[model samples]
Target: QLEPLPALTPEFLCVLNDVCVKCYTDFAPDELEVSVREHILQDLEGFVRRQFSGARLRLFGSSKNGFGFRQSDLDICMVLDGQDTMDDIDCITIIESLARLLKKHPDLKNILPITTAKVPIVKFYHVRTGLEGDISLYNTLALHNTHLLATYGAFDNRVKILCYVMKVFAKVCDIGDASRGSLSSYAYTLMVLFFLQQRNPPVIPVLQEIYDAQKKPEVLVDGWNVYFYDDLKTLPSRWSEYGGNTESVGELWLGLLRFYTEDFDFREHVICIRQRARLTTFNKQWTSKYIVIEDPFDLNHNLGAGLSRKMTNFIMKAFINGRTVFGTPIKVLSPIYPNQVE
Candidate 1:
């Protein structure tokens, strides 16, 4: 039998809260940057309209999900009506054409169409705003994933704060970029959500379970069920039984680090928050990986599939260090060095 963990005191909670609030404010994108990014999206939408009529371009990822940082890259997904499968469509030709069209715009630079990539995308740089973005065709699953994250962010303020703090920590430690064989910001957000959901007195309810109870309409995207309770109005009634936890944002943050470092069994269990139940690595057949973060919409997609063993060790070391730092009292001053004595 395991003993209950020690409770955080009010004084320590206040200190952690202050640190979280400051970190969130410092990392969040400014109003000007948000407006500029929106304008760029609109301009791109117009460009897409001129060529591919009846097509829609929408924003996804951190920029639209409320987890974006000051310098986060924008992820756009293009959905064109009457297109069913990639087999019927020549994505490379379409991407190449879009690249040529975007090149005409003086404000858009470094337009590169990477057709052979797993998730083919056309990357570009916005000269005017100094921001980067990528456009992928028919990545509708990402849109639903974005909405899910947004709903989670709105469900609890602490979710967003802790997520932002962790994202910043990942950046500072240089292990946040998935393209470089490390975890993505989205994966980090999922890790935080999983920790919160699995807490002793869970901070939030399992959203998918709530949705299932309501018998809400089903949404199937690319053969995967993408349904979830997204209405904030009805959420109160659903989560009334769970009530609210008195844990501070700081306590939750520290708990997140400690949970990942000390408690979680990465080898045996999957980091899944879509359901209230625990999923095994054996069930998912993801045993060979260091971490398994399932994409809610795309069941086959593992967000942590790209993470290498070396990178996993680096991330674990960082988490352990973070847990030690945040889980204990901080030293306000450093000892004086004898070599620097005047």
Candidate 2:
């Protein structure tokens, strides 16, 4: 059993809030940095078009998502002008050729084609800007996912702060690199959104669950519905619970740590953001994984499906330690992690 937490003093809560806000201010990229990514994308598209004339690229992931850091990657999704989709074999073939094509470019180096990943990508390093990027073919679902996350991040300022804090925490704990056998920064962002949606008098509404007609509208992408209530101008009227929960960013950050470690039932429930109702692990037939995070649009995809037994334990322990460190009322708190809790 986890040890009981002490009552949080108001002064410490103030400190916690400051730390959460600082996470965003310190890590977020400025406008000039954002424009450099766009320039890179434009230049890459022009270069790739020399070989594949119809190639069109658009930035997604943290690049387009609101909760991006200065050093975050450029997730570019490439699609053909005439063709709508490509089979796995076609994708791999294109990626392999793309790698060779990129290697010939003067500015790009380390052109590796990762055909084994769920989405095949041609990874490259932009020498001038020192930014790493990957181009995936027909990543339509990811484009939608980026929009969904951006919508949430724009809905509330507090949401963005908490997500930044969560991502920072995950990176500090060495549990946010999906390429390194852990969850991605995207997964951590989804977890923050799920917690906010599940909070009492929810901080944010379930975007996918809100609709006008008797039935929800369908916006299909890659055979999955990508529709959500994105009209933020009138969201106050649409979501009855809008602006209901006015908790500070610091409180929400600590609450999120506690929610995952103490309240969330990893064995029984799945971290789903598409709807407000709790989804069971058994319902998804994903009882095999201890931490099941259902992709908002892609129902078959579980973000935590890649975690090993040891990694899951490691992730949980990090959260448990985070909960204890943040929950206790102490005179001094480390800026980020628990180890420096002086």
Candidate 3:
């Protein structure tokens, strides 16, 4: 018979809460910073509009999802109104044109036009705010993803708090950059959401599962059904069966760490928050990846597809270390250092 894990004592919970609160305060961007970023985006939008008529820019990722940290890069998506598909408009041509346009702006520095990249984007730095941002054309999937994350964050403040804390922790341990064969902050947030959804008396409902049979909302994005109950007001009545989870942010944070470190089988399972059930990696044909996280909209896109074996081990080690620090009891104060000799 397996042994049940010990519960976190109240004393330890208090300490974890204090640390999380401090981390949240220290890492979260202030209102002034947000205001400045919005202004910069507005200016960029105006410039884009001058060249591409009917083109509109929208913010996504951490900037709009409420999970951004101080000085985090902003993600913007540009949607050209008349273009139904990528074939309709040459993405590389438009991106190159936009890059050249942005280069004219003195405030926009280090402008790089990456047309051949997977998600072709125009990366640039804003001189005034010293903030970096990438503009991708017709990335509507990212827009939906941002909305999904925002909804989750709004459902429980703890979700946002834990996400911010985890992001900072990943950055500190140097395992958060996706370009370097690790997971992105967005992927980390999904992992946190998956853990929360699987918790006993789950902190959140599988939003995609909450809807009436006759009146279900249909949202088909990029050939995938990305439908989910987004209205916060109606969610309470729809998900009345599951009462509020009384777990503290600290407890959930620790639980998240423990879940990733001990319970989750990265090779066999797929992290899918869209449904309230386990998805197998074999079924998805994602068995080869060390960490498989299904993209909510683009089912075929594994967020962790870029992770190599060594990077997976590094990430797992970080998780183990995190669990050890947050899941176990620690001495509040070490023995006082010996008095220095005069």
Point to the candidate with the largest TM-score.
Answer: 2
Give a tens-digit lDDT track for model 3, residues 1-342: 123445767866887787777778888889988887788888888888888878888889999899887789989999888776674248888888999998998888999988777889999998878889999988888888899999999988888888888898899999999977789999999998998899987888888888777875778877878888888877878886456688888888888888887788888899999887899999999998878998877898999988888999899899888877677655556333222221
Cα lDDT of candidate 3 equals: 0.84
Point out the worst 10-residue segment of candidate 3 by lDDT. 333-342
Q: What is candidate 1's lDDT per residue for 208-319, written digit by digit as tens?
A: 7775443755778778888888888788787864556768889889888878877889999999988878898899999999789988768788888888789999988888
The parts of candidate 1 lying over 4 Å away from their true place are 1-10, 82-85, 212-217, 331-342
Question: Which candidate should be chosen as best, given lDDT against the real structure?
Answer: 2
- What local distance difference test score does each model get? 0.82, 0.92, 0.84
TM-score, one value per model? 0.91, 0.96, 0.92
Q: For residue 315, give model 2's deviation from the true position in Å.
A: 0.3
Q: Which regions in candidate 2 have their CA more than 4 angstroms from the true location?
A: 332-342
Query: Over the stretch 1-342, how does candidate 2's per-residue lDDT look in tens digits?
Result: 989888787878988898789999999999999999999999999999999999999999999988999889889999999998999999999999999999999999888999998899999999998899999999999999999999999999998999899999999999999988999998999999999999998999999999998999999888999999999998889988888898999889989988998899999999999989899999999999999999999999999999999999999999999998878766554454324443
lDDT of 2 at 28: 96
TM-score of 3: 0.92
Candidates 2 and 3 compared by lDDT, better number: 2
| Of 1 and 2, the candidate ranking higher by lDDT | 2
What are the runs in model 3 whose C-alpha is more than 4 Å off? 1-8, 334-342
